[model samples]
Every structure is written in structure tokens, then in C-alpha cells.
Target: MSTIVFAFSIFCGWLIFDVVKHRKLTLESLVSSLVIAVVAGVFWWILDLFF
Candidate 1:
């Protein structure tokens, strides 16, 4: 479940960033998206482990 959530969050982050900046997906958006996604995923996973 956490893995699914992580993947979904990454997709959402990318979509939002792309929409806000370029109105479409771009290579630059992918880099930031991955970064945001990884950080968010790790945080979520840690929280899940605790609770």
C-alpha cells in the first residue's frame, strides 16, 4: 500500500508541477518530480513503519 501511495504521489507531483510551470510535461519537470517523489516516499515509509 505504501509503495502504491508513493508512486501515485510522484505522478501527482509531476502533473501538478508540469501544469503550473509549462502547461505540459517536460524533461525538467521529471527531475524535480523524481526528487519530490523520493523524499515524500521515504518520509511516508518511515512514518508507516512507526505507526
Candidate 2:
């Protein structure tokens, strides 16, 4: 479902950011991760709408 996809994207983004940033948990990474997640979710949503 779209909801699952969105949540998964968010989790993936967070995990990736955390892993790539030397495992350091910072506010900047957290914010950027959320942004990435939202963008990915919206992109997927649009694709779902069209196809």
C-alpha cells in the first residue's frame, strides 16, 4: 500500500543517513532525513496516482 511505502521510505532514509554519517545522530541529519523521506514519499505517491 501507499502508506506502507511512505513509511518504509522514511525509515530507509533515516537508516541511510544514520549509517552514512558515521553513526552520529545529529539534528541536521534528522531534518534532512525527514525531508528526503517526504520527497521520496511524494514522488512515489505521484507515480502511484499516474500508474
Candidate 3:
């Protein structure tokens, strides 16, 4: 749970950075960030489970 939360926070940070750098927040960016976050969380979870 904590790991998941941490992943989410990191995602939020990335999203914010993208928005700031681009000077506009778009739906595509939001969706991509969500997708990336999910993939990263899954990868981390699997790694933690195995090692």
C-alpha cells in the first residue's frame, strides 16, 4: 500500500512538471501519466514480490 502510494505521488510530481514545462495541462498528458504510473507500480510490485 505504501509503495503504491509512493508511486502515485511520484506520478503526480511528473504530471505537474509536464504541465509546468508545457504551460498547459492536457488530457493526453494526464492519461499518459496515469498509464505510466500504473506500469511503474506493477513493475515495482513484481520486483518486490520476487526480490
| Per-model root-mean-square deviation over C-alphas | 2.1, 2.4, 1.2
Query: Can you rank all candidates by lDDT, best first?
Result: 3, 1, 2
* TM per prediction: 0.66, 0.67, 0.83
Candidate 1 lDDT score at position 16: 90
lDDT tens per residue, model 1, 17-50: 6878787777778777777777778778888889
Worst 10 residues of 3 by lDDT: 2-11
**Colliding residue pairs in candidate 1:** none
Cand. 3 TM to true fold? 0.83
Winning candidate number (TM-score): 3
Q: How much lDDT does each candidate structure score?
A: 0.77, 0.75, 0.86
Which model is ahead, 1 or 2, in terms of lDDT? 1
lDDT of 2 by residue, 1-51 (tens): 875678677867786868686777777777777777777877888888898
Alpha carbon lDDT of residue 45, candidate 2? 80
